[model samples]
Target: MAQLQLGPPPQQQQRPAQPGQPGQPQQLSPQAPRPPQQARPARPATPSDTPPSGQPDASRDQRRRALPGETVAPAPDETVIAPPRQRITNPTAVFSGLDKITGRIIAFDVAIDETVQFGALQVTPRVCYTRPPTETPQTTTFVEVDEVTLNGEVRRIYSGWMFAASPGLSGVEHAVYDVWLTDCKQSAPVIPGQAQSQPPATR
Candidate 1:
C-alpha cells in the first residue's frame, strides 16, 4: 500500500528537438550538398606507354630472349630486322623419279653440290632455295639420297627438306625409289661438252 508521485517527473515536457525527435538530440537531417567532384580526364602520353606501378618499365630493359613456348620476346627496342636473307640466285634443284623396276619416270637436274644418278638413287643438292617472285612460290630443296646396295653397300636413304610445294612433303620413300620436289633451277641441263654462254651485249 504505497503511492509515490514524485514532483520532478512532471517537468519533462521540454521537447523542442522535433525534426524527427525520438529521444531528443537527433536533429541532423539537412544534407543535399555533394555534387562537386568531377576532374579525372588525363591519359594521352605514349611513346610506348608502360612505366608506372612504382615505375620501372623501360620494357623491363627491353625484354626478349625467351623462346621455346615464349612468355614474351622481341623487344630490345623491338628489333625485328629480318628482311634480308633471300639469296639462292638459282642454285639448281629439279628432281623427279620413279623407276620402280623400269616403270621409268626419271627427270633430274641436281646441282647445288651436284651428284645426280637416279637409278639406284644418288641425287645430292644441298640447299637450293627459291622464294620471291614476290613471295610464296617456295621451292626449298635440301635433298641427299644414297642407296647403292646389292651388298655394294652405300645406303644413306633420304635426307630432309624437299618441298616444291609438297611433293608428298619430303621425298624419296623408296621401294624402287619415289623421289619428288621438282623445280628451282638456274640452269643445269646443258652438257654435251658444256660450252654455251653468250648473251650480254644489249645496252
Candidate 2:
C-alpha cells in the first residue's frame, strides 16, 4: 500500500505563469454594479417660482450695453404726456369771399348754426373758436358749403376747418368763388326786424 499524502485544496493550487509572461493578473468577479444609482426625477415648476412684477430683468441691462464698434438704438420715451385739448366757445365767424367775374371781395358774418349765400356756394359756420388774449392769436372755423344746380338740386361741396392765421391753408377751391375764415365773434348781428337782446347787468 502507498503511503497516504496530505495536500492543500484543489482550488488553492497555483498555476505557474508562462515564461516572458511576467506575472498573472488577478481575476475579480464583477458585481452587478449597483444598477446606476437611479437618478431622482426633477421637481415641477410652480407659480411661486415666477419673478415678482415690476422688477427689472438682469439680462436686459446686460444686453443694452454697447459692444466695441456696435451701434445701439435708443429706447422710446413712454412718459411723454400730451397736452390737453381745448374747447370752442365763440358762436359766430366771419368769412371772406372773392368773386372772380366781378373782381370784388365781400365779407359776410354767419352765425354758428345758420347758413349764408356766398355767390353760388352756401356757407354754414358749424364751429368758431378764438384763443384767449393771453395766448397766440388764432381763429378756427368749421364751415360747410353747398352748391345748387340748375335743376333745383343741392349738393355738398366742402366741409372742413379753416384757420384765420393761415387762411390759404384750408379754403374753398373754386373757379368762380373762393371762401376763407377771417375772425370769430361772440354774437351774431341783430336783424332789422328781430329784437336785440339786452346786455347783462354788471355784477
Candidate 3:
C-alpha cells in the first residue's frame, strides 16, 4: 500500500485566480468602411455677393438719379435746333416818268408780290427814280408792259434798247438821249408775232 505514485494527477490544480479581473470589451473589427469623406461643393454666388441690406450694386453705381424734370437723351450726333432763315420785307423799286413827247417813261412795273406767312417769300416795293443826264437827246427805248386792258389798254410789248433808229436811210431827228432802267425777271410774255432778230456783234 505504500507504492501508490500520484504525481501526474496533481498538475490539474493550476486554477487559483480571483481578484477584479473583468477583461472582455475590445470589439472594432468591421474595417471596410472608409468611403464617407466626400463633402466639398459650395461656391456660386457672385456679383460680389452680399448686397441685400440697402441694395446698391448694379455694377458699381453708374450715376442715374435725376427725376425732377428728366431730360437726358441727346447724344447720337447731337444737334437740337437751327433752321429758319429767309426774310426780305420791302425790296423792289425802279422808276422814271417824263413824257412831254415820249422822252422818258418807265414809272412803275417790277413785280414779285407774295404773302404766305412762313413761306413763298418776296415783297418788293421801294424805288423812286430818275437819274441819267437828261435834257434832250431822244433815242431812248425799253418797253415791257405785258397786259393791262380794262380801259387803260397796254397789251403785250417787250423791246429793249433801239435808241433812235435811222442811221442809214435818211431819217434825221435827234436830241439828248441816255436812258437806263432795270428790274428784271421774266419767263414768258413778249410775243407780238415775234420777228426781230439781229444780235451778233461782240468785240
The TM-score obtained by model 3 is 0.17
Q: Write candidate 1's Cα lDDT for 1-203 as tens digits.
A: 89897654545656345665666575554586557899999987675776677866656544543556756755555666758656465777887788788788867677787787777778887878886776557777777889887877888878988777778877466787778877887776655457877999998
Candidate 2 lDDT, tens digit per residue, 72-170?
543332244657556457878888899999999988888888988877889998889987775667889888988876777878888999999898887
The segments of candidate 3 whose C-alpha lies over 4 angstroms from its true place after superposition are: 1-90, 100-144, 147-154, 159-203
Provide the global lDDT of candidate 2 against the true structure: 0.77
- Which of 1 and 2 is ahead in lDDT? 2
| Descending-lDDT candidate ranking | 2, 1, 3
The lDDT values for all models are 0.74, 0.77, 0.36
- Tell me the TM-score of each prediction against the true structure: 0.33, 0.52, 0.17
For TM-score, candidate 2 versus 3, the one ahead is 2
Could you give me the TM-score of model 1 versus the true structure? 0.33
Q: Which has the higher TM-score value, candidate number 1 or candidate number 3?
A: 1
Please give the range of 10 consecutive residues that has the lowest summed lDDT in model 3. Answer: 114-123
Go through the candidates in order and give the clash count of each.
1, 0, 6
Using TM-score as the measure, which candidate wins? 2
RMSD from true fold, candidate 3: 29.1
